[model samples]
Target: MKLKTEVEPRIDADERGYGGVCRNNLARSRGETHFYGRCGPSRRFFACSAIMLLATGLAFAARPSRPSPLPNFVLVVADGLRPDELGTRAVPTPALDQLAAQGIRFTQAYAGAPVDAASRAAIMTGQHTGHGRVRSELQVPLAPEDVTLAEVLRSVGYRSAAVGIWGLGWEGTTGLPTAQGFNEFLGCLDLVHGRDDQPAFLWRNEVPFVLKGNPGPAAAASAFEWMLRGATNFIRINEDHPFFLYFAPHLPGSSSELGAVRIPTASPFTNQTWTPSQRIRATRIAYLDEQVGKLVADLRKRNLDSETLVIVTSTASSDAANEMTEASKPRATPLSESNLRVPLIAWWPGKIAGGRTNNRPVAAWDIVPTLAQLANAPLPKQLDGRSFSALLLSQPPPTNSTRFYWEGHAGGLSQAGRIGQWKGVRALGKPSVAVYDLEVDPTESHDLAPTRRDLVAQFEALFAENSRTWSPPADGAVGAAGRPGYPIPTNVITQPLRTNSPPDGPATP
Candidate 1:
């Protein structure tokens, strides 16, 4: 759709600040009309004035009414950010806070899983880990047939671009964003390479290009800046068109296997009295926030602020055990409430009401349907997510599923099902289930399974049903095994060293 344009004649104004018939090409094209002082009378001038007014009115009447332009979309997914760390006194994420203030903040938002790939898969395909094609990190690539958010938006005439760490695909794989409906893809393909703080090369679409920089302690910062530049450029180029930008920034998450975490030497927190790991994590968070602020500012400067929907969320929560101060740490003991719950902020000036907070439960899979609804795009027939656009607009919540399901085998095979206030988790090879009342105990600390036999049975039944419907790929599949559940300790450390593998048997719970 074409943008609306208004034509106004520039005229000299009197001391009262009122303007007279301005001279411009618009007027000249109609006819050579002469005017005297404002409101001055002359038979010829009066005739001309009446004709001009009539012509202008007719022109306006003749022009067909254009529909409102579809708003552009910017989906910014931070690597591993917890809800509490965002906009809190300790973390100081001003950019994210400003976004929350400008739009709606979902108090109970969750990732599909407490890991990267599965959560991202849910976000992209609008399906939970059970229904989504890719259930694990790097284990199963997104099949070409799977309908993605980009594909939906592209079908509706939106130009789509993806930047940063795309965990769905690797080099020479069909899972690349370009193949998955993004018009352009600029960043690392695999999660491991993406985790690299100082990678020698990054992929631009299907082609790989070596970066020109000295590999050192500042590599991670440099890589992040590169991705940000690509994102901004995509926005600048597609400013006039309805575009979809999937900007995934790999920050805060450690890529230590490649080298030391690249903490910006000039970070504001560098001089603070914190541990080395804490400082590094803080620097990354601060840097990521700064980039987000810059991107938002750029949108406003380009006059696209009102015509764009900017969402800031994370794939998963942070993995660091003691990253924050003791007082700021979450009280919840279960991974369901702690690691899975993420910060979700949607910002669109004038379109979405500001300073609104939504306490409704939402999951990462919900993003796909939400974006589809906003863009007026068609969704796949089989989808696990329902549009939460209503929540963003302060309207009544959509007819959505109340129960959210998650499954993983990273550390150990485990499944969790949350139905309203109650959450039940069962590990593979475990006979009993652990249950919690999230409403009363925000943390999944108090397991009500032993006392509440009925609740445990209900959760167990729910988990079994969900698993039957959306089981991960069979053992020894082409892709990596789906890592679900919470962040647990693992024996083998993968590159980037982000997630914790589950142990051999049932967990402590």
Candidate 2:
């Protein structure tokens, strides 16, 4: 599971056109990058170099030529749900907890970039700062030119489909699950009505579904059953070929008040009421867990579970970056540590032991690469993430790995990279920097900027690297949560196209 060494070869300044650029790894460029329209010779030269590096990494590698399609992999994301919040006597997420036990649970897993669309974009495209895009309400798409996990995997003979949120890209055009790689797309393409609104039906391609967002408990249960039916249908119809199922459940923070709960089934609900904040969430989670368990059971019943690799994660933490002091803001909706830490679990029976945890720093961006590795598909060069296939195989932990970086495109928030024992952070809107001995202060309580001169210098270099790649908040912009349901709100859903999937709930627990 060794990471392939990237060619960081240096060509002559003359040959590389690298002349007269701040020599010796300049920490910070004096001024901002000139716009493409206002570029000079040196600016053009450096820009060309960056493009070359990007091109080299993003090249679509050879696809499998033989008749054998790759193994089917499922990636599930529980939005806004934090890793810590699960399975505690506090939350009792038995299903998620069980998945964590079977898979290598990363203690320091992070969102590629905080927020859904952007972080999800990072996961799909495998590009670090370069692929960061907004997918909240107003959608920004992954550039059509970029290589995607689905695209590459599809090329290698796998049938790929996406369920749940495809928040990136405004419409189903450039940023759609199908366009990227999925052959079929299901679930809510995007959510606006607090996860219980309409669009509320399934969309095969761009066709609108009849089912409204399952605001009622009955609808949720039925919809999930429909999904399982879909999966079962898929397996029955195409059992001969391998397929990738990206199932994203639409159950969000608030579960009870959103809609009707009593569903028609062998098992019926007793008109139960769930409180909004925590209780409702628990109910929603439990229901979703049941659906997952059912899906797994079906797979096992059909002898398909062992052949599938199930990976579940969330786009961001459930809490607000800044605690939800603002009533307009939901309880958990910010970039704070509480709000950004997400759940990531991988389950491959007989491969991943039922109860092992690997607290390495993993991120959503790693999904593309890790999936590619698991399926033995081609790895594109442009991916900024490294696969944790070793951990999935229950191997001993590595002593060290890549430094996870975070920057808030919407919040102007920036952070330090994590080495084994230390961490560093910087202000995105300003030039201030801070460093911490992570071993000593995992909470990042104190800013040792003033006292540790050497640490500051060390971190300054790291921060500079982050800024070059990540785009800061677009000047001054407020996010889309303020304007619910507008197709093109501030950031998440603003592409020129438009497509919406149905919102749904189910007896997932």
Candidate 3:
């Protein structure tokens, strides 16, 4: 469908008006994305404003309604999911695979950081950690001065709401979602506060929802129910305005909350004292998936599905659950495709071209910049991730530029950098370096590190470059009390991201 380029219909009257419209059209032919180069937002905003206003006012001489404007943007980021887990191919997820059939399926998408805080920061700030924002927690955050995805969207006419888990800078005060750009925030603050049995205090904007103890499954369910209801209601109230709904569900680990459901003497879970009620954990995942299903269904029920762009991904893997070191057993880090890669399905019906798969490497950091481009919002100055917006239309990203990078793990051992088919890693900040040609080895089984010394060297150089440039946030940058350790801060950028578990691969047939 031909997209509506103009904001509104205009009555052709004067020559100057037509000329202004033509000039704006020429400028617009360039692309709608607002940029932050050497010239700051002031120039960018003026340029964007002049274009939007001119298009809205005198650009349209005829009443030819173009294709519908952007659908309501709904980004769903599920936690702790591996890419292969999604049954999207020969064996597909009836629901998520259905999503792939109805939208674009990204095979090689990765989180900015293996952990939540930095990943979320990258998503919000549209910059790389080297810029010094990814490592900060609630108390020490991405900095209040930083402009976020919410702030950028809010500047536009988009009504926004964030529910589920929001990890980065999740302080009750300035770090809360509200301060970052969301209009309505109904979520908890810390990482481990909320539970199925004893509910954590839910924060509404900055205020915690006054509650007695033990809100239980019902309350958790209620909060989720309220999330869908609130966003649907918001859409109904402001259907004229485009809106963004960010839902990051926090499901219980195989142990954590699930363990509380039953007293375990010696559970199989690696966590010392913490063991997930495996049964409970599985049940809860199913429950959360169903919640996601419900949310999507509700949008359709409200006649808002086709007009919405739904994006689902994880903020990042849980900290405790993801502590896999040689010294530590398989604590489970989802940063690898087996663990870290989350589900990413964008549903925009006719606009997004359903049933197409783009396996090019992409990152969570790209989401903010992409959204800003789509919304015609002005982009922030610092951005590490590039917008793969073209993929939404089945187009290609810039050649030789689909690599992704991340910094995570206890000792920042869980590092990630990808270029084309090649991937580099140094898990848990170890001396071990592994390399794989993802084109051949999606499941990083064989060690190519020794053989491909040149590729490894290239990747190592890249890693060093990113470290210095992106500044992978640490105790130092985020203002922590203790100085972070690099124990062996050798400059080897190209190495395998070491996994705590046995090498990650598909369940052996």
Candidate 4:
């Protein structure tokens, strides 16, 4: 038997977004001839094939090119990080500063709550504390039915992972990352464990791995390093696919004591003239900056930098009392600018224009919708946040409403609302409300409420409406006291890898 073959032309879009031609083989087993016009000779056949190839190339050139792949999201939430504390003259955060220079920095970013757990819940659910399931650090567990950013992204083929501090709930709880949406969960789940450096146990998906170490200041640094390794590994493993990596590092927060703070002893700030507490806090912040640099460098090394959207923000502002001298401490009431205003930096090379600063007030809840938009995922209708993804692209941000509301019940029923330049605060058991013109009094020293009753009334009404609109769930207290030890079955833990199916999606492969 004789074999016959013809060159088939294939054209595709090259990296330059232009058409390129290549040859493929079209073969037949037996001697079969197909011709057009007169019976074609070998030279005529070659000529006809070349003409057809040219036409195919022209057709491909006229067709529209495929769109770029969805960008990967890396949300790095630094616990208790204040905007002033970052890239400041006192403590230079070169990594964060570089990120701010490369991306738009929201100078007026506010957390949904003034505390950790509620703020993180709001961030994940895209709802403010008024509407979120959890409103306090350890009072309410995130309801299983609540939709999380990970669940939304996972539904659209994104592999979601949570590394580091997840204060939503403990292992085996409905609020656990595995139950919520993450395909993988490697970190502390309980709020108490998150606050400590040497946690008794940390969760790897549904399984808990007991950590063996002395509970010293160095242990916190070591724990942060361990979490960083997990984050980098997840990024490496999911480089080829769209992924959402929630990298929440617990750092710079005061240790169990008032004077004791955990930071690497070898921190460069050891020689500083500041008090030990100040040096320790500054060192912790610098250490976080260094880790961020590492993550960005790794992405660049893997050629994934341009395709990744890296966001750096905080759960809440740092405790100023810990880092500031007694004489220099600003009078920051609960839910004041000092406690609410945190830094938000979004970096995507060539996609987001660099060196831009936005002062428009944005809340942490907005992070969810913004990321959902970037990932090409459907935004959940129940979300209280509007996507600021347009703002990152240098477009005018959506102007649905300029007013934002927040209320904290941990200390007391303290309510705060900001409408454009005016900010109002009403604390429970206080006779009068406090209002400030943030444009002039960013420190919130002067109370404009006494002078500007009109603005105060407007803000008070807004807060009241928000409070009435969303009340805390009746069963919210379930699992409030988080489980401290490992909760995984022995058989499951001993296996190679164990994963539970998320409420809204299948187990991550």
For residues 27-110, could you state the per-residue lDDT of candidate 1 as single tens digits? 333322211122223467668778998988744432232254788999999887777777766668888888998899999999
lDDT of each: 0.69, 0.55, 0.55, 0.70
Poorly placed runs, candidate 3 (over 4 Å): 1-70, 88-94, 136-139, 170-172, 195-200, 212-222, 252-254, 260-276, 317-335, 412-414, 428-433, 469-509
Estimate, for each residue in 107-226, the C-alpha lDDT of model 4 and write its tens digit: 889988987788888889998877777776554656667889988887677777898888876645678786777767777777656665655455676565554442544543255655
Q: Which ranges of candidate 2 are over 4 A from the true structure?
A: 1-69, 129-131, 135-138, 170-172, 197-200, 212-225, 254-275, 318-335, 396-400, 411-416, 428-430, 469-509
lDDT of 4 at 150: 87
The estimated TM-scores of all candidates read 0.77, 0.70, 0.69, 0.78
The better-scoring model by lDDT among 1 and 2 is: 1
**Where is the poorest 10-residue window by lDDT in model 4?**
29-38
| Model 4 lDDT, residue 452, Cα | 90
Candidate 1 stretches with Cα past 4 Å from truth are 1-68, 217-221, 255-265, 325-334, 399-401, 469-509
Q: Write the per-residue lDDT of candidate 2 for residues 1-509, one digit (tens) a residue.
A: 11222222111122111122322222112211100001124575568668987988765323222245456677776666656566766445677677777666777677766566566677777655433554332346555666778776776667666666666543434666756666666555554422543334444445444443343445343445555544544443234457777776565443333443333333222333423344445555566676577666656655666677888777775432221122254353243444556777788887777777766777777888888887887887666788888778867655555666666654555554655566666655657776777667766677787998887787677656554544434522224452354332222321211122111211232
- RMSD (Cα, Å) of model 1: 14.9
Residue 24 of model 1: what lDDT? Answer: 55
**Predicted structure 2, TM vs. truth:** 0.70
Clashing pairs in 4: none
What 10-residue stretch in candidate 3 is worst by lDDT?
31-40
Q: Report model 3's TM-score to 2 decimal places.
A: 0.69
